[model samples]
Target: MTIPHFISIGHITHDLVGNGITPGGPALYSTCAARNLGISVGMITSFSRPLLQPGLLQGIDIRCQESQKTTTFANLYNEHGERRQIIESVADRITSTLIPPEWRAVSIVNICPVANEYLPEIVRLFDKALIGICPQGWMRRWDSKGQVFRKKWENFKEVLPYADIVFFSEEDVSDPKKAVETYLPYTKMVIVTQGKLGASIYSHNGVHRSPAFPTIEVDPTGAGDVFATAFLIRYFETHDVPESARFANCVASFVVEKEGIYGIPGLDDVKRRLNVAR
Candidate 1:
């Protein structure tokens, strides 16, 4: 079969995505959003058969795997957004050989990771498409008790220049003053998602910002990945950053207004909100 239009090469995870554990990751959230938008999406993820959520990889067209057991976590959090993450298990490392042959034709790739699952060399294998990354998963570090903490990043520079777009959370770019200095020169766009506060974009051409659609905040776990996937997919379609940001923001708003990964909105729902915003 031809490769799916969008291929998210990242983790297939069991997420304790703040407040509760759910099956999630770029493969789960991004591809679901992309496919709902009429974009064909595939995935290459690691999972242990027993631990992998049943039906986790269904609907997705192309999927590759190394291990059957995927990462599992206990994500505890506060109303204000502080989170305590405990990694009950971690997935296997994904390499080029682990990818399906058809991945060569996917429209876009998101190096989505719950841990550092995507290898830089594996990323180089795909032809130039919109290679976006939402690395919050890879950006995690936990103490002895598995209470997660922010830590300095490594290997980002090696793979960032290869990225057409990169994603960050409000916490990711907390130091926006340094963002441009730190990231703008490295990739095509840097998206900093601030939940209901909205997302800010810095690109080689200019800086732009889009506020989130107002919604009741529920689970914020994969909200950023949802936004990143939607925004990048919309941008791929329209090439209009602001419009894409709004569209993505709408989907993200819906994600947070609900419970978990199962709540990703369909294209009709996304457009309805976008129309409301318009």
Candidate 2:
């Protein structure tokens, strides 16, 4: 089996925006960001559609468990730009048994559960790789009408101890600082993204604030996923937390200026923007 440098496991979603249905989810966005940064990437997901669409992460390895329905979300934005989501459909859960043996040794692993499709035990599947957890999906609950709402991550203790780093948006929790405080005891590092306001990083060393790069915001769909992906990739390479946060913020700035995967930038483009931001 060909081992990729990065691996993201979750359910790839079909998101409803305006009158169009687009492929989305953290796993897909992370793979696109990883590929643009010139890293060999692999994704494990459960989807009903063709896993690799035309012009989407063409060369990356994507493993799929054929499912009856793809995880779907209808995004409704208010006049103030806040988003309200409805779960239109859902795919199958990604079980540990679906993971390939060789892929366990990948350098960086991102367990991105976009719709609560992952079990907490799946975090233990990796050995020494840096495991980044994006738990928005785990923190969500929907009603009979499928309206999404934030709920406590009931089994966070079961998973956080095994993760090297945890990333989430301020909107994902009631209080971002308290959420970071809650996660720091179990994980080595915790990052709470505040969109245009920037991000905060908490680690053993101390808390560092990384400012966002100014850009015209087009769509905020996968900005957090791209930020987490860039941070993990850069941190894995250099082990510099402050530098990684700044680089991540710069990379994510580009993604929000465009729609969906088209916003994911190459390393050179990111470097240029990083230099300008400095």
Please report the TM-score between candidate 1 and the true structure: 0.91
Instruction: Please report, in order, the local distance difference test score of every candidate based on alpha carbons.
Output: 0.75, 0.90
Q: Estimate each model's TM-score.
A: 0.91, 0.97
lDDT of 1 by residue, 15-90 (tens): 7653555677666788777877778777777777534356645677745565756777776778687666777677
Taking the tens digit of each residue's C-alpha lDDT, what string does model 2 give over 116-207? 89788998988879999999899999999999999987888999898999999998999887888888999899999998988999998898
Residue 243, model 1, lDDT: 90
TM-score winner: 2
Look at candidate 2 and give me any clashing residue pairs.
none
